[model samples]
Target: MAAVTSKVSLKLMIDTESRRVVYAEAGKDFVDFLFYIVALPVGTFIPLLNQEMVGSLGNIYDSFANLSTTYLRPNVNKDSLLSPKAYYCGATGLPLHVPNVESSRKVYRCCRNVTLDRNETCSCGATMNQESKYTVLPSANNPYSSEGDFVKGKVIYMVMDDLAVKPLSTVSIIALLNKFNVKEIGDLEEKVVDLGRDEVVKLLKASLLTKTILTDVFLSVLKEEVNCQQEVEGNF
Candidate 1:
């Protein structure tokens, strides 16, 4: 099932829709958005506004993810891989942990049939996947369309240090994970990439929508330099 992101996470989206005025992360309209406020009222109108709000929120999310890439590096296979094992609460059944694999800063040498890009493909067709270092168990392999070389009672361990060697961004890998139905386990999650406040301010200032969203605070807003529909309309 595809996960539906709550429009609650989107403050900027609410403003662009012009349905409710969002002065900060909280206002009378945004009160219930916190998910933990004791006295907040859940409005009858919020879900009704969801469709338009969703489309706009996606815009902010996408632009943030794209803008983030220039500042971050892709996780990779090699010395950059983590040394300690990363664990999951319940992978196939029991608690699981990827064994301590070798950590190297060296990128994986594509000496075989696998190209640089091909090595990145997971079984699910995601090219940005981490490698499973563990042996797949026979029973687990049996349930799926098998390569027919099934090992039993084990889980495939992903190379961990792949996350550490790169400048982790809040957006890219998480987006990829969502697309591929991948889950994070252990303390090594890419949850908080922590864009320095300066970085966040810089992005909010540079982003075109952000300029529109925060125009009052930023008097001298520079426009985003991009090819847009406005160009095609101008031609007409």
Candidate 2:
């Protein structure tokens, strides 16, 4: 997995009256990160949220964490469930930077061409653990050949508050505006927000628990800033 050091910028269209994010205008990098969310394992969500997931899955994960190794099979590793790797065809370059979650690597094979574990003996009895590097060869059928993960690069996308994604277009924007009953363009505000690891993590959590994902993840922060300013004014 490539280290994503740079932050992705999202141009959010917020409804001031509703205190909600109507949609976000995002590029390939942000879209790629959104698409990558589905590829994550069920177990990974717990660690990503620091065990604060809003369901019984957290309890199950905690139970497993406290389980004794002596009662389990020798082949079973706790880390396997706690930090299962997600396989992606191409580099996602997500800024989330999940600690143990990583993209899948090439499968290890024995010299006899039998499927075998790395450093373990095969049925054929040859201990040749040949490591083959996996590469996505570009072809006419390959959609990922150009750039980006899941979606093609160089195009902007529209991301709804509920995490629904689509290519940005005038029609789509108008449709969303109509759906939200947005009569006045003056009520809509455009804000460019920088999404780093912390913000992305909050988004991940919000996506799981709330339908108004963008509003829950971002608007609350804006409300806090407003409240702080009001408090300072009151102090005067």
Candidate 3:
């Protein structure tokens, strides 16, 4: 599959005084990417981040990676565990890309319609090696099958700093502002940021590690840039 070069734009409402992102106003693309994270396999987490996770999960993954295949059953494929396929088919055009298992996986069947092993013999003695074509039927309950990811398209979503997601509304905005106790409107700045692959990866990692997902992932980088600009101005 080709790389996803597209970037999604997120309009973040940042509190200047607090130096934190209150929430992000986003579209289906951004929301879809966030939702897709939930479907990722447990084995992919440490490898995807290229760092230690919060607990002993990282150590366990490392041990599995280094373990010899000699001890395992002859039919076992190690790659199946280390880099398992993600079976979700709803998310499309995601900036945070993972290969769709449904599309890439090749299925073979015998007359009995068994799909487990390609070369295994069926009860009728027929070899299950004949490649079969299959179609993924869209769920009857899926309303946005025409053009949408996990959620419906053409709807603006509000993603909180803690990764909470909801449909955008005037009432929601007002409630958020009141919750944050924003006395001055000037302190709340709306900034549109482009999220590409790298930013998405940071988001994925931050989502797992912290409750202040947006602040921890984006705010620290923003502060560093500001600090660098100040230093440059001082030198001039």
Candidate 4:
């Protein structure tokens, strides 16, 4: 069963120092903006943009001959073995956290035929196997097919440090957690430890889609970036 994001009341949040309109969400309109907000801070905006928006942005590769169509296509080649796989909540058919697991693996294995290393451990606290780490718990939003793409027997868990390491920025992660009704870092730490890495990732990422996070994040960004004084009526 997919988890549907809960609805939240409308409120404007402000970023006093930067004076930038960071969040501008209200009602269902705000829900559409969550992915955009996440992509901006992370600097992976191009991949997430829709074709209509991409078209308005102009040809990504106008100078390169015959490449306009190529850039306009979907972000990845679904059939390519090298294409990146996105994770999702097994219960909800939404894009979940895509952890940076490849970097955290202490030991990298090329194939199943490779000899095991006795002294290696993955970020998830398991002995490393195949060199790359991937999630197979059923993310409906994932472009790749789970059957052909993921290893059959590997134990998949959410990765904590990966996004933190992406240095997704302290504020963003906290904001995401807050939307999930997680109030403090200590609570999140315990939750991560209790739920294990994979579940935490799913929970946090999926939580972004929730009405609480969506509204909070939208208002938070607006408080930070949008010119609230002129655009909005009063103080947050």
Question: In candidate 2, what are the lDDT values of residues 137-227, reduced to their tens digit?
Answer: 6677754442335677899899999989999998998898898899855669998888887787788788888899999988888789889
TM-score of 3: 0.79
Question: By the lDDT metric, which is better: model 2 or model 4?
Answer: 2
lDDT by residue (tens digit), candidate 1, 130-211:
3323333346423321122212322221211111112224454464345434453121222111122232233223332232
Q: Candidate 3: worst 10 consecutive residues by lDDT?
A: 98-107
Q: For candidate 4, what is the lDDT?
A: 0.32
TM of each candidate vs. truth: 0.16, 0.77, 0.79, 0.20
Q: At residue 27, what lDDT does model 3 achieve? A: 92
What's the residue-level lDDT of 123 in candidate 2? 56
Root-mean-square deviation of each candidate, in angstroms? 22.2, 4.3, 4.2, 16.7
Give the Cα lDDT of each candidate. Answer: 0.27, 0.74, 0.72, 0.32
Off by over 4 Å in 4: 1-144, 147-211, 228-236
**Which residue ranges in model 2 land beyond 4 Å of their true spot?**
1-3, 87-96, 103-132, 138-148, 226-236
What is the C-alpha lDDT profile of model 3 across 1-236, one tens digit per residue? 22555888888899987788999999988887777677567775667667637888888877888989888666556666776655443334354564423323356777757553465555566667888764445577743232235787899999999989999988887888888888654679887888876786778788778899898888787788889999999999
TM-score-sorted candidate list, best first: 3, 2, 4, 1
Name the candidate that leads on TM-score. Answer: 3
Q: Taking the tens digit of each residue's C-alpha lDDT, what string does model 4 give over 42-97? A: 21222233232323322442233234546744433221211222222232222322
Clashes of 3: 0
Global fold similarity of model 1 (TM-score): 0.16
> Model 3, 198: alpha-carbon shift in Å?
0.5
Query: Residue 226 of model 2: what lDDT?
Result: 84
Report the alpha-carbon TM-score of model 4 versus the true structure.
0.20
